[model samples]
Target: MLRRNFIAARDLEAELEQWQERIDIIRHKLKFIRQLPGVACIEQLNPPGTAGGRIPALVEIAGGTAIASEENGLLFPPDIVILMLPGKSIEESLREIGSLLEQPWFAESPALKNNRIYVTDCREYFQLPGPGMIDSLEILAEIINAGDFHFGFEGLGWIKFESGSPKNG
Candidate 1:
């Protein structure tokens, strides 16, 4: 009985269709990355007032090299940095983002030096295993790919990190 229910829940046909769509999108995205070298990115977060640390496996499916891994390996400076914030509230999240940007080490990181740091709500985008994964992939592709793409916050659940300014939720 359990096996039968599990099989039903699998929704094999829908899963296959989704997989096919993802493959097609990947093929299309790969064209743009063909001439470009792989980008190095790191996922991290700064809580209210402490030093920031790496977020594990956040970018594994994002098609870039993740400088921070779960093994506590030496971190390499990244080309792109994604900062995830705890979803306390919009105002608190913004404050934490500002705190992170103000850190001297953060300013010195390669991502910040190159203005590649992006801020997002961790819960909606990174904390859960859900359909948001697709949006996360798309967001990473837009940032890493060579194109004039700007990060937005409607359905993507993310926004560009701009220091000294508050992002209206």
Candidate 2:
């Protein structure tokens, strides 16, 4: 049976309201590229050198669709590639990703050709199901509509592949 929902505190309402405000701001910044054209995102947790992985739920929340693993062989090209690694520092993760990018398949993928690769720390962002989910949504929104927004990644825990370093603004 489906469980009923409950609101335990007034502060929860306030927190939600704050999240909504942040979402609205992000949505506004992403209005131009609301939906990535032919976007296909994959989330690999604790990648190559490590173990454990899962689909990223934030894709839908960020307004993009997630390509099922079963269909990996069917797509001609995906417009985006997202690497979600928990616990690893940005440098280590990037090194792993750089190797992956060198593979024939990944090198030819449209996501790389168009420079749409992104990386993030799952521990600080998308690993679990929680209220903090909104942060990942916002980060993806910012990344997807990057061209339109021309903004920095400062506080966001995610990074675009091309930037090579975290943004301070």
Candidate 3:
């Protein structure tokens, strides 16, 4: 859609092509990891919504299954939990998540127990649908397959949330 829009406007063809090539390269690199089985739950806080969006598709592309809100009713604990608060910084997101920490389900989830909970800066990466989505994809890939991939997006794009840590709040 973005590409078509740019084409229609007759501008940025070179930039769009560059973005497409990068996206294709990342997709190719993630092929093997995509075959791996893992469940991920993404919770958007500020403008709360389900995992029924582009983020979920990004998760799948990065090699994990995103548990949608409907599926959440089944009480399936996700292996990875991603907290997204659009327009907020990581510190702000962490502060917001502090309230959720007291919830039994969130505190006791496998992701929290295993230190798989992550907080993301949605404003820069996941908030709007644009070329930056590729960055969002890379962030998810790094989080989902920590051992296998590392695109250096840790501190800037997202951060691992250690439950109960003072720094988190």
Candidate 4:
């Protein structure tokens, strides 16, 4: 009986891993998501001694004129990385927008976490133009799972969301 339980547990873990990979693929295929323009991607260098706060990378919005101050990083949950942009991306503009936006956090976090790219992708929309976006960090903290991911925008740049449950957007 104990042996059977062990096998079951191992299989469950494997299944979860497969699900995570599948979710990652789906996220990558998102036409709107991959093309988001991150203004800046701030990287939190893991030093020998320092109290790590949040957001490993900082971003600057392209054409949006938004900047991320360290104070803003403190506002988010430690686990989440926020991607900020000054403006929103229409489906037609996704490709161009993705090119304009930077993604330092997106690049660095995956390496830090052994290529768990999608999880890093679903950070904050830092410079998004909304009072609610800033205030929403706490709420995002609850909804974002350890391995899930998402993004959203609003107003001129108010879009936003989080990632979870391997499904199409």
Best by lDDT: 3
Per-residue lDDT over 56-157 for candidate 3, one digit per residue giving the tens place of the 0 to 100 score: 788877778877544223145667788776677788888788655654455555676677888888768787666788788888888888766678899999
lDDT (CA) per prediction: 0.49, 0.57, 0.69, 0.29
Task: Tell me the spans in candidate 3 whose CA falls farther than 4 Å from its real position.
Answer: 1-11, 34-41, 44-49, 70-75, 164-169
Model 2 spans > 4 angstroms off = 1-8, 27-35, 38-41, 45-57, 71-76, 149-156, 163-169
Which consecutive 10 residues in model 2 have the weakest lDDT in total? 45-54
TM-score between candidate 3 and the true structure:
0.74
For residues 22-59, could you state the per-residue lDDT of candidate 4 as single tens digits? Answer: 44443344334333322222223221111222322211
Per-candidate TM-scores read 0.60, 0.66, 0.74, 0.24
In candidate 1, which residue ranges exceed 4 Å CA deviation?
A: 1-12, 31-60, 69-74, 86-91, 146-156, 164-169
Q: Rank the candidates by lDDT, best first.
A: 3, 2, 1, 4
Count of clashes in candidate 3: 0
Local accuracy of candidate 1 as per-residue lDDT tens digits, 115-145: 6666556566644444455555556655555
- Residue pairs in candidate 3 whose N, alpha carbon or C atoms collide under 3 angstroms: none
Residue 82 lDDT in candidate 4:
31
Worst 10 residues of 1 by lDDT: 47-56
RMSD of each: 6.5, 6.9, 5.6, 16.9
As for TM-score, the candidate ahead, 2 or 3, is 3
Question: What TM-score number comes out for model 1?
Answer: 0.60
lDDT, residue 162, model 1: 50
